[model samples]
Target: MGAAEHRQSPVGVRGAVAARSVAVHIAVLVDEVAFLLRPRDAGWVIDGTVGMGGHAEQLLEGSRDDVRLLGLDVDPAALAQAAERLRPFGDRVTLARANFRDVRTTAARHGIEHAQSVLLDLGVSSWQLEGSGRGFSFQLDESLDMRLDPSLPETAAGLANRLSESDLARILAEYGEERFARRIARAIVRRRPLGTTSELVAVVRSAVPRAAWPRRLHVATRTFQALRMAVNDEPGALRQALPEAAELLAPGGRLGVIAFHSGEDRIVKQTFRSLDPRRFAAVEPSPLTPGDDEVRENPRARSARLRVLERLP
Candidate 1:
């Protein structure tokens, strides 16, 4: 859990490493979140998407001894990792296996009246994409079951194999904003019953012409991202969690959200704008992104955008 876990200057990571480009990356914006939330000034902190407790651990270590944190996540596997990581902090840290959307009720049940800071790092984590063999990444040829929460009924395979061509296209276009959504959806329907990540990847590759493939992104990247979002209902959950976390903030508390892509960023930006400006101030005119060093060290963080919304008295 030393530098290998993570090491940054402003945020807190360790070791020297070469960053490589990948189809998907975990963009936590740890430095910006740690800086803007001002953990030293916080009493109770909440990490709604506390995947592996990276940010939670950083906040606790950076904060005063009295500061406590409540960490929540939909993924049980992630919660297990977090539990082990945060064990050293004892009762100062609380871990819950729950979705960020239910943060309001979950926080209340935990006897937390309000939080001094709340954080939500949207989309899949490094563990899910790389470690978890649940087929989140194209690199893994595992089953197309991308369920963050085990209890979730549906799987990415279900959507890819069951949804109509048009419906599937809509999800790709809207959720992933892929230009070749229609072609991909059509290819998927024709090759229905795609049981594995490799199968789905092949179908996508066949659908998009080699000439039209993105330079940096994999041919199947958008399709997988869209299917995962549809299966998990990410957009819907995000819409609910933003306001809930915002309202759960104390008078001076700030809610920090790190969106990895444009679609998720749009929701975060629009939702922050919809809040009462008099009551909540989005101090950052534009979202803060990972610095050159952070991106150079961890290329996965290149697309991260951190937006802070502070509750006013």
Candidate 2:
């Protein structure tokens, strides 16, 4: 669909031109992110997961002077959309096709020593979940290719077909936090060579008892999540990126992250707490969640958790 056709809600766009060109990807906790990062005085700002440049554009517009922004994302389509939306900013913004895990190398390649602020919005964008034909959502009947970056060697289909029942169980149990992982894994192994999201959903439904189906969540949700996380090595990438981001921040500069799941939030909490107390302090003792108004407007924002920390002098 064209960008104009994708308008669901108007976000933080300042001009009519940008509002028209940019798709409707409602950035979760935009005000909270801006408050924590406060790039108005920062010379350089980094958006580690600049999905559609919603947050990046807001930061640039909110800034006072020439604040250069470095935006990184693994998906080429997302980068293209971001480029189009942010074209008005001219040379003030730089877009890179890379994962957030490579933040250090990307910064060095761009000759950036340190950044005054960094933002990581870890949740998958609405565009990817709803529009991308790469099978990120169980509601879609697309191929089971959940690689956020198409260039990635592994796909969800490969993981489902190749892994042993026990290994698959471990992935579902650990990554997905599903209680009936073993039964689901066994069912998946028996239904080998599943190529599409519909097939996987069917297998999961058959394995899980009718009474055990969650009230709010789909039975196939955990299985799909585990497979996607395994294919992308999401947790490992986050672990690598956190330390690098902490080290790359200028003194008093802040890093803000928005996580959708518990596993991701746990990692963010632990990593931020592990930083030397003398040099780092949590901006908020507890993670921030979306208010009732935001959740009512965008259901996806309901599970988002925002965390911020600052590097002290």
Q: Pick the candidate with the highest lDDT.
A: 2
Residue-wise C-alpha lDDT for candidate 1, range 1-313, written one tens digit per residue? 2211121322322111123322322335665566677455537899999888888887887777888999999888899989998999999999898989899999999999888889998858777998899899998899999898879998999888888999999999998899999999999999989899999999989999999999988888888888888888888999999999999987777888988879999999999999998889875778888767678778778888888887876
Candidate 2 lDDT over 1-313, as tens digits, reads 3212212222331232222332343598876666567564537899999988889988787775668999999999999999998999999999999999999889989999888888999888878987989999999999999999999998999999999999999999988999899999999999999999999999999999999999989888888888988999999999999989988888777788999889999999999999899888887788888766667778889889988877776
Candidate 1 C-alpha error for residue 193, in Å: 0.8
Best by TM-score: 2
Candidate 2 clashing pairs, residues 3+ apart or interchain? none
lDDT of each: 0.82, 0.85
TM-scores for all candidates: the values are 0.90, 0.91
Clashes of each: 5, 0
Cα error, candidate 1, residue 102 (Å): 0.5
The alpha-carbon deviation from the true structure for residue 36 of candidate 2, after best TM-score superposition, in angstroms, is 1.1
- State residue 291's C-alpha deviation in candidate 2, in Å: 0.4
TM-score of 1: 0.90
